[model samples]
Target: MDQQFGEQIGNNLEVYMDYLFIKSVEEDHMLRDTVDTFQQLWKIIMKLNLRKCSFRMEEGKFLWVIVIKDGFKANPEKVQAISLIPPPISLKEVQKLKARLVAINRGRDVAQNPNDTEESIWCFLCEAQLYGAAEARKQFLEVGGDPRPVMRQAYNMFKDGGDPEKLVDAFSKGRESEYFYASLYAGLYYESQNEADKAKVHIVASCNSPYGQRSDDYMASLAKVHCMCRNWEL
Candidate 1:
């Protein structure tokens, strides 16, 4: 960023790898700086997808943590997912539970707006923890038995040597939403099996597809966030 805008606008930006954060206190300042930043990037032939771009957001997620006007806090959705699981009994389940717990770390201290009232739920999902949580949820559903299995079918397609490319081909033609979503979960299953190449292909396939790029759903950002957190190729 400094290489482009130099000191004039550099201090207001918080960039971590490819995640660029532009901060401004006043509304007018935000508007002016945002335009300036874009114009500068455009000169270099760099462009941002306006659909994926968020502006004037009072609250949102950054680095997997919830960001409010005051400061950052843990994501409640993840906490809810983890909390939903019953205590593990089997040794394997216990290990799985421990892995999930280890992923939640509330160590960062952002002083911009301190909140004494905030509950420290704390975390960002690593690729392992992300898929592990899915695995746990899958087990939770399969415990007694699923007479009609949606989650099982989704999780097993790759696990059982099903062709992901064929699934992508079929889903892509059926519905734009289905294609993106199916590919995302398919990537997770591949990742769990240590199939990085397959995982990357599926993960990339999950995003920027016809429907995903056009949809207003929050999951559209999931693939990018997943890649960023895991250092996977985007």
Candidate 2:
């Protein structure tokens, strides 16, 4: 709940709400008081500035739908709703719902069907979703699947001796090393141009990573880098 995050949520409530709803309630099958749930959904709808938006329960299922006054063609009505059978009660069922929603929101191709664009997109989206969540939740072990796209994003951000705060923000919580290291290198570029304090910050952050295994090899590599800068010893 950083101030910037609050502002971001305010700015892109639609996207964030979609994500939040998917992550917290819907996916998890966590039931809220019926009125409160609708109220929360209504809040998000308002933020989207939708002309016509509402939800309904039919045949013991919930249907959340949105209709922009004059947006797209066939589906000017972009609808996404959770078809709830009843109030969720079991933790196990909730977990399944969570997993399914995670797969859907992330565009993860859980089915492994290459011909399906939705599946591929879902898979990639799922990866991006997982990437963000893992960072926030400090779950680095889960981030080892594919580093290509993630690295690419980090690299672009690292260009031209990127901002330390921006790099750190993008690095995620427990998985700071990847971009933290990238930022350190980028910061070194600044250091070479006489930005010692900035370089020190990045290096120190990496040296104190909460995620990277503090293995001897990792520590030694960090020690060497620190030594190179004549900043810290051992």
Candidate whose lDDT is highest? 1
lDDT of 1 by residue, 1-234 (tens): 435544433345544324556777676788877776777777878767777778888788765577776767778987887889899988557756766664443323322211211111112123244564345333221111123233334534533346556656656665677778667767766666667888888888777687666777777786778777667765
Candidate 1 Cα misplacement greater than 4 A, ranges: 1-10, 16-18, 88-95, 101-234
Candidate 1 vs. truth: CA RMSD?
17.8
Q: Score residue 133 of candidate 2 by CA lDDT.
A: 27
**Model 2 ranges with Cα > 4 A deviation:** 1-146, 157-161, 174-176, 179-183, 211-213, 216-224
For every candidate in turn, the CA RMSD to the true structure comes to 17.8, 17.3
**Considering summed lDDT, which 10 consecutive residues are worst modelled in model 2?**
136-145
Superposition TM-score, candidate 2 onto the true structure: 0.30
The candidate that achieves the highest TM-score relative to the unseen native structure: 1
> Cα RMSD (Å) between model 2 and the true structure?
17.3
* Superposed Cα deviation of residue 82, candidate 2 (Å): 68
Write the residue-wise lDDT of candidate 2 on 1-234 in tens digits: 122233323222222213321112242232333344456557556343345343332211112222232211221222133454344688545545554455433312211221232233223323333343223222111111234433444333332224546655665443444654555444443443356677676665555554333635553375356546574532
What are the Cα lDDT values of the candidates? 0.57, 0.38
Model 2, backbone clash pairs (residues 3+ apart or across chains), number: 9
